[model samples]
Target: MKVLVTVKRVPDPETTIRVKSDGSGIETDNIKYVINPFDEIALEEALRIKEKLGAGEVVLVSIGDSVVTEQLRTGLAMGADRAILVGCDQDLDSLAVARILAKIVEDEGPQLVLMGKQAIDDDANQAGQMLAALLGWPQATFASEVVLSDDQQAVKVTREVDGGLETIGFALPGIITSDLRLNEPRYASLPGIMKARKKEIKEVAAADLDADMSPRLTINSLEPPTQKEAGKKVETVEELIGLLHDEAKVI
Candidate 1:
């Protein structure tokens, strides 16, 4: 079983983000980057699956420029067999990313594809579903648990929905997007890190894939959210009720 996992390099969650002065994008100077947390979970799940089967490949794929290799190396250190980096310097929207991934999926021909439900930077949770749509494959998103059949022909995924947990089954050649509770990602050991340095990281230019690199969506501007007003203390219950009814307009 060959499992293809998508990895994304994102700003470290602890890093402070500031919008560019011209509103084009976030300030990247001196920012720390790491693998997207959800994608890390997805990679971990893929590694676990391969380890359990004892005879499978876990391939990591990422779409970005040379800097993304850092995150790819991290995935390789976590036990991925190899990695593919789709080289693109321009910022791509969700649809463009999906198109690129679809092209890679066709080429790799993996039995399963795993990725994060959403990217932290954009919070756009559209890629996995769009990829499934383009390939006409079954998709299970927000997966918290995944189980593969002994024959490796089918898979069962437990996902989180608005109401509660939902379990679904599908055959191989499908996609699953990892959620927070999927699994705990392991830290790369020293030996693993050293081995990862030797692992192959194949870079393919985005233009070579023949996927449309043109972004369908455009970002007009980005701005920091407005600061909230400080709360006011009410001395009496009647005053609080008046504030809610007339000023706050809740009533």
Candidate 2:
């Protein structure tokens, strides 16, 4: 069983984000970067699956500039057999990213492709489905649990739906997107970090993938959200009622 896990480099979730000077995008300067939380969960799930099989490889793949290699290394330290960096300097839409991943999937021919349900930065939950569509493979998104068949020919997945959990099954060579409750990600130990430094990470340019890397959407401008005014205290119930009826108007 060969598994491909997709990871992403994103701004630290704890930091405050500010729009760029020209309102084009967020200011990444002086900001810390880390692997997407959901992607980390995906990696953890893939590593667990590989360990259970005891005879398979878990490869980590990321799409971005050289900076993304840091996140890939982190995945390697977490027990990924190898890593691949899709060198794409420009910002790509979810569809374009899926196309690139599909190209790699064609080349690698993994039995399963696991990734996050959405990237926190954009919150676009479309890559996994788009990749499945591009590759003509079955897909199960927002997977809370994944169990391989006894024969290892298929996988049963429990998904987190709107009202309740939905369990579904898919044959091999499919894609599964990890949800938040899938698993807890483990921290890379010192030995693992040292080993990851020695592991080979192959770099492949986006152009080499031969996929259309054009953007289908554009952001005209990014504006900061309006700040709310401070609230005033009402000393009496009658005063509050008067304010609600005259100014607040909720009543």
Which candidate's lDDT is highest?
Answer: 1
Tell me how far the alpha carbon of residue 70 in candidate 2 is from the true structure, in angstroms, after superposition: 0.8
Candidate that scores best on TM-score = 1
lDDT of each: 0.95, 0.93
Clashes of 1: 0
What's the TM-score of every candidate structure? 0.93, 0.92
lDDT of 1 at 106: 95
After superposing candidate 2 on the true structure, give the runs of residues whose Cα lies further than 4 Å from its correct spot: 231-251
lDDT of 2 by residue, 45-145 (tens): 99899889888999989999999989989999988989999998898999999999999999999999999999998899999999999999999999999
Q: Let me know the TM-score candidate 2 reaches against the reference structure.
A: 0.92
Model 1 ranges off by over 4 Å: 233-251
